[model samples]
Target: MPGNETTHPLLQRFHEGDPAALGELSDRFSPALMGFAGRLLHEPFLAGDIVQDVYIKLWQRKGEYDSIEGIRKFLFVATRNACINQNEKYRLRQGQPPSSEDADPDEAMRKLILSEYLGLIYQIVAAMPDKLQQVFYLSFEEGLSPEDIAQQLDIPRQTIKNRKVEVYKALREGLKHYKVAMPILLKMLFPH
Candidate 1:
């Protein structure tokens, strides 16, 4: 339940041709995909269409993903490409110049991944103890230095630092059940 730990097994089931697994995957990722597509297309209905197309492609290319990570990456990448193609068609239809939105595929993927990552982090942080959650929001969301956070909260700088460490430790432990290594998760969470 914590951080999609079952994604691998679900994906494996999907690879084994279980239709229900595909449905589960769709239910899990459709909201995120819709949001990503909507952001790119600026049209809710078209975004839904794009996500539907992505699912159709997934079914067509069944058994292509060997890992949960691969499937996640593929879905976002395909959705982005589809969005770009849609944008190009719209521009041509309107007789307008194509926008630069799709110029960098890598950047788009990064944004999509980061969006999902932060959403997971937010869920985890929200479930944390109030004090620890405060520390987390101050340090990460508010972009405050430890010392600044300490001053703002009237806590010692050392306590603030300790709370930060505790927060990371809790996150690592909570996320470990999801099979994500701490170092990689930390790097993604705190990319600087």
Candidate 2:
């Protein structure tokens, strides 16, 4: 980021399947993304997985990011979203999502537009059945192997695998709308 250090134009080439670009973007943003995820998850171990989830999403949808804001916002919003989504799902064992007043930001640069769409995704995830969503979030966002999640949760690993499959299917179906919306939203937002 310094004047002398060469920064790859990762935002440009990443969508084209450039691994080095992906690496560069990860390197550049990892600290901030990690911190954001950590804050949202309120757990260090889980936070690391959340950050990895961001990277995974980025890789899977590199072509989806219309701008740097798309990437940045997506990471932050998704982190918060995953946390809130899980919390809501858990609370529903009783009923209702937790009503935490999200602090207002003073600047747009402090947020990611990608997070907005991701938050929507999280809402969709939360609407899923409790056990299924829990398994999905644990494995998908936290990157726990099905076996590990099962060991930790005292559930069968096969159950975890089945839950993950269901979660992804639901997410793919729900977030399919973003494939069309992200670019259009980006064009409206940045006008570049």
Candidate 3:
């Protein structure tokens, strides 16, 4: 978990009580944390609140974590716990029996990993040029053929093919370290 210029390079500054570093951390992790909590609680509004609180807690415990890994772990765990607590309260308010089905630690962990990975992929895609982004969305997300995308965008079919290659290369470069999950992610992206 070495810090890169694009990712969590502010851990030391954060530990030293820098507000800008905390803001960067919030910007970096909030999306994945919100997605995890939203999936758990099925309420995006509550998820936002929970993620905000988790960041505040992180700021309070800044000295406790020496690395971004520690902060990442803390954010996920704290968000999950907060979501579970909120669910319990909702169940009680509704006069329903408490159920453990959604509280499975393994399932929650899987969702967290998936959300985080997807967030990274989205960040990579978002940084691409507008034309590349359009091609990527049409080809991968919409499962459009190169011919169809070229016709739709009024670009040459060969250009569509080339752009698709560029998108794949970008994704691979960004996600190269996650070797075990690469196949599954590629399968998802390249449905053809």
The lDDT per prediction is 0.72, 0.62, 0.77
Q: Per-residue CA lDDT of candidate 3, range 47-145, in tens?
A: 888988999899899888867777877887787778878988888888998856567988767766765675566657766787887887786657898
- Residues 96-148 of candidate 2 have per-residue lDDT tens digits of 65644345443332334444554555555556787976775565556677778
Best by lDDT: 3
| Clash count, candidate 2 | 6
Q: Pick the candidate with the highest TM-score.
A: 3
True-structure lDDT of candidate 2: 0.62
* lDDT, model 1, position 119: 43
lDDT of 1 by residue, 32-115 (tens): 576567656744469888888888899788778766666666777788778778978888888998765469888877766655
- The backbone clash count of each candidate, in order, is 0, 6, 0
lDDT of 1: 0.72
Worst 10 residues of 1 by lDDT: 114-123
For candidate 2, give the lDDT of residue 154: 99
Q: Cα deviation of 44 in candidate 1 (Å)?
A: 3.0
